[model samples]
Target: MIIIYYKNRFISISESESSTLNSINIEFNKIHDINIEIYKFLANNNIKNLHLFGKNPEKILKKLKKSFNYVKAAGGVVVNENNEILFIKRRGKWDLPKGKKDKGESIQITAIREVSEECGIDPEFILLKNYIDSTWHIYDESTEFILKRTYWYTMKYVGNEELVPQADEDITQAKWFNLHKLEKPLNKTFLNIQYIIELFISQCK
Candidate 1:
């Protein structure tokens, strides 16, 4: 039997079961199964704040030594030519365009691609600047385990083209919000997002 562990759960693939699971190899490939089992184990044991790592004792200890309580992720504060910032109303909240990086893509490319995909604006006329800030948050509901790391960047729009939001992706609308109108609505937005906008405003002054 080949035993694999991740996110605090043990997964065993016996030789007898190998023939039936021909297409699957690594335990990571069975992430959904792993997550389900992890959740079940957690519920059964009434465990919270579980620390997960590889089964190798040394690796596990090393990971725990370097682990953070929260995860890191990335986002963007995009301002257009009118001096207004591009914002998206998503899931009844005002959100900026951003997401996780894809394989073989640079951080800058991730920012530009995410902005274009979420806002339907081409990157050709957008001026992307250095990373503004990074925020850390805990995301537990979506998965049984694993934290995310995100980064945020500031981008300036250079075109006069009309903006269109990607409606199919839960982004209902995208438009520029003036500075005066930006605060109140943004305060009601995601906390990290609000902070990023405030930082951008402060930097401009």
Candidate 2:
């Protein structure tokens, strides 16, 4: 049993301990009978560990019938010559730079662009040797939805430019931290982000 909470309410779900639901579609007719708010309905019924989609309940039902899909892509993880990783402070949380991929851009270019836009340093050197795994979580700025995928790449900085955080993007500051001093904060990062760093370190060994 897992309880999904959204908008201050919980939805209870029971499944075989070893079974997981990857995606679920709740029709408006069925959802209207659940006695929960629309957002909570979607949140509670989402396929565990899979993408959740929430919009106007009626519209979502329509899209479900057609199998409409939603996906967003981003890139991140920046490192420097001193074996330090660059991080940004945003919304009072430490984070790596990442943003949506532009049309016509390759994922690698998206990685470089996001790093440069957020940190103001062009990578002088880069290697595309590994790919960090994917993660899913609800995004509810306007309507609840999921960020389907965020692609991560380990990058080495080669530029001589000074660092600048993209202020308008809500990034307050940017700086590099030596790995030895990064344990605590890195542990607090999203699990997938932490996994990427750990994988990179293990590969170096």
For candidate 2, write residues 103-188 as lDDT tens digits: 88887787778888888875555444467644332345564444344677777777667889999999888888896689755855
TM-score of 2: 0.64
What is the model-wide C-alpha lDDT for candidate 1? 0.62
Clashing residue pairs in candidate 2 are 124-158
- Least well predicted 10-residue stretch by lDDT in candidate 1: 15-24
lDDT of 1 at 30: 32
Give the per-residue lDDT digits (tens) of candidate 1, residues 74-176: 5688887677888888778888888778877787888888888888888897788868876533334454344455678888888887778888879988888
Any runs in candidate 1 off by more than 4 Å, and if so which? 1-73, 140-146
Measured against the true structure, the TM-scores of the candidates, in listed sequence, are 0.62, 0.64
Between which residue pairs do clashes occur in model 1?
A: 72-148, 72-149, 72-150, 73-149, 73-150, 73-151, 74-150, 74-151, 75-151
| Candidate with best lDDT | 1
